[model samples]
Target: MSSVCSTFISSSALSIKPKCANPSRSRSKLRINCTVGDVFVFSESVIEQKAVSTAEPLLVSAVRGENVERPPVWLMRQAGRYMKSYQIICEKYPSFRERSENVDLVVEISLQPWKVFKPDGVILFSDILTPLSGMNIPFDIVKGKGPVIFNPIKEAADVDKVREFVPKEYVPYVGEALTILRQEVKNEAAVLGFVGAPFTLASYVVEGGSSKHFSKIKRLAFSKPKVLHALLQKFTDSMAKYIQYQADNGAQAVQIFDSWATELSPVDFDEFSLPYLKQIVDTVKQSHPELPLILYASGSGGLLERLPSTGVDVVSLDWTVDMADGRRRLGPSVAVQGNVDPGVLFGSKDFITNRIMDTVRKAGSGKHILNLGHGIVVGTPEENVAHFFEVAKGIRY
Candidate 1:
């Protein structure tokens, strides 16, 4: 019922305006008349049968369950410490806050990986905690100690002090940066925007910083469930609006990082994390139904099945789960991204190639995004990261 643009492999560059409904077959002989640019080069074989819109980014198409030649590729933290260029920038701008908050710096840091690797997705360089300060929660990313909350919230009164996020007023730089990124990337890649999930954001503010045992947040969850729920609600509302704001500002897709939610038991996660996540997803979908929403939780092997209930378009896996198992477990309703070990980059180039092939093969043909299970490690070889993208882009269905 929808009109979409598709490129055919004929003599010249032909942009065909075609109206095609989603075919019933998962793998159909008919080629989909949807525009997936140079980043996704499909072979003569059939494409997946999901309804797609007009020429969108390859990552957007892949996540929408549309059949593409190969899965779109982008790492979780593709724009961080691993690159020499990023390190050089860090030397100049010592403060992580300065690097992430300033519009020019955010755009430059975000595009660093895009320039070098030409990733299919150029995610915002801002931190999940970037919005915390705007929400009346003071925090800082210390060089060695990681994130530090000035005053950890432990009670109802502290939760009361948390202000609702006003992205335009507080973080207009985020919107500006995303707008610029979209202009830079054009139709070649998806400009990804991300926010920390309510539970994870709550964890950071509740625990005061990163924690190994996570006892502080768990204590608050187990003992003072009401207080934790109150805080989570505030974050849920704020982040849902934040996603909308990003999408309105030209972010093609937005990912929700629930990095610390895996620490909870299934029962606890259901009570604390699931509802808030679902609320955020439901809220965003109501307004931006076409925007792809991705949810990621590190070490989420145990929580895979529960993830789909949140209604996100994609579920990113950590390395603990096998690609084959993750694909089978998540089924076809949700697209899958990642599960490659970041440490694999340290292995030989042949090993990295084999792993990429193995993951691609296991993920089957459609609805996959080749990525590291987690962020590229601090010491990951830049050449290997380049190799990861090279092998990934060369894959065909």
Candidate 2:
């Protein structure tokens, strides 16, 4: 997620039946396309459970479903626009790419939240689309317009131009910054690296930028399925390598952000989003088996059970889903993170404290990571955020 993102699916919209299909399919032959969203009624499927590796960092340990006295606490966009320190840095360096691509600036901004809040996870101050240029998808983050792709991909020819990302070649700064963050934090917290899930990145490239209604991507999905599938496949391979690149460099854990996954109905999500996500998880697991992989899809109340089928280590919940219900759906096999409304920080400290306690109690004990349901909204009080960390860290089982 960027500093700001939008959700397309309304909670009241047609709900996906909890009955799920096999969401995990390898890359060799993924012909998951169906009649848009009318496909999956979800029948029971076997879910493979990976043994949780023991790790030092609290976030890693907690994600592994380890026995921890307190669940790790970190916000989705902890190192972001809301922080005054980041605002000061943004003023100095006006360019989003410059701030994110420059090793020194990225390191400084990523550590800003860590220094002030001492979060359990220190996510890299980078965007999900940071690797686009390396993949031959030229883009820029505009002030009010958000991301703008110079040439939006639509045809078979356009998809061919999008190259497989060589992370060390295109985004060395990211790897270097992650390495430095690991050294600085010294295992006190997990250093997170993230990539946009295929469907989400494809949205930016296909639609030219963020859309209030994702009509273009939907059109491609409905009308020209092959074209969209080709694009998604390219991203699937590129991102798998990107995750491995980040893990090899120094990232303790990596999060996959499918910000636009909710835009598609559950049936459509299986075809367009799930297979590629499972492929990425599968690829990363081959090498970095112990490294924790987390997936976030905003407003994913209906898709909770379907997420674990993708084989991710942890499934991050949005505020729309209750923490307890989310925990129960994901089961003990998958670790759970988030469900606290980011808007809660705007409330009084007592309200904030009460919500945290309620979420914690409902989440029960092990395998829980405390975080905002979504990114911390712009203009959140720094004091309340500090209090969030204070109260969350103070809790004990």
Candidate 3:
């Protein structure tokens, strides 16, 4: 009898071969024939369950501080504009919201990187502000202008209008995509889910989208602290639920992106960002203790020591900090990811290899996830990225 696996059938599905980096490995052991769609039906054979390959993904093991051969590798925006395949998809579906919110498009976009790079983790292709529309805040991801909030929350009344996020109702596509990604990747790699941290979410909603100085949010924080606090509270409760939803729906680990949290001074971060992050971490921990939570704050060199206090299992560092120093500062209590400059990918192959080796060595043996300090920049040489993963995979303790 042949084993079976769930497969989504649709016109948009792309046929691709499974990972067989070593030609010696039999196709039967690794194949997971799947496609991108919503209507699900079983295919001929499931991803094989081989006795030797059943161990948990290296990413999960490393996150738990378990000793492993080397750090598992994946990039922040591994499945976005940088890929030619993704760009083709984007051309067909020009609307960012359409591409990201639809289940079929989400699954296809998320798997594009997996198909080529075979990164150790496959993250869902969605946005941090995805929940905003569900939260009663109308928004759009304009092509060039970026996120555009129809009505920016300015006063106390706006806080009351902001609803708590209900992930299943608001973003069912997210759950569906993650579930499909799990079957597609199997234990070969971990499936990752993510959400925007409260303050960062609040920043977008409050500032009406991306801001240069973030003056409006700071003004609210300084003058009407209570109002800002109210907004943060709603986001905190909603994001906690969002994290739990992602984990329960096949996400092996969830990353909390606090991209704008570092915009606040240490003193302000403690007041606006830190406590809310702690609340989300605490809320999720009670329900899903085994679910690893990773926190990332862009340009976080000033707040490295304080990140672990949120109780996340891993802390991701941007390129501003040295990997060795970041590892020391973050300490051994939490695992570490990133610190490589994404620009390194634009350099010569040898230069990229050396940087990968340097970061891995500085990160030490276990409790590390190799990644770029930030998302892969647009116009990056795809060949160099291939080199990055090639060198990273070849590393041995």
Candidate 3 structure, TM-score to reference = 0.87
The C-alpha stretches of model 3 lying farther than 4 A from their native spots are: 1-52
TM-score of candidate 2 versus the correct structure, residues matched by position: 0.86
Colliding residue pairs in candidate 3: none
What is the Å distance of residue 379 in model 2 from its true position? 0.6
Estimated TM-score for each candidate: 0.87, 0.86, 0.87
Count of clashing residue pairs in every prediction: 1, 2, 0
Off by over 4 Å in 1: 1-54
Q: Alpha-carbon error at 159 in model 3, in Å?
A: 0.7
lDDT of 3 by residue, 1-397 (tens): 1121211111112232222122222554433333222211122211222233457988999999997876889999988788889889989999999999999999999998877877889999999999999999999999989999999999999999998789999899999999999888888889999999999999999999999999999999999999999999999999999999999899999999999999999999999999999999999999999999999999999999999999999999999999899989988899999978999999876667567766776788789999999999999988888767755665556
**Candidate numbers, best TM-score first, in rank order:** 3, 1, 2
Q: Report the C-alpha lDDT of model 2 over 290-328, residue by residue, as the tens digit.
A: 989999999888888899999999999998898888988
Stretches off by above 4 angstroms in model 2 are 1-55
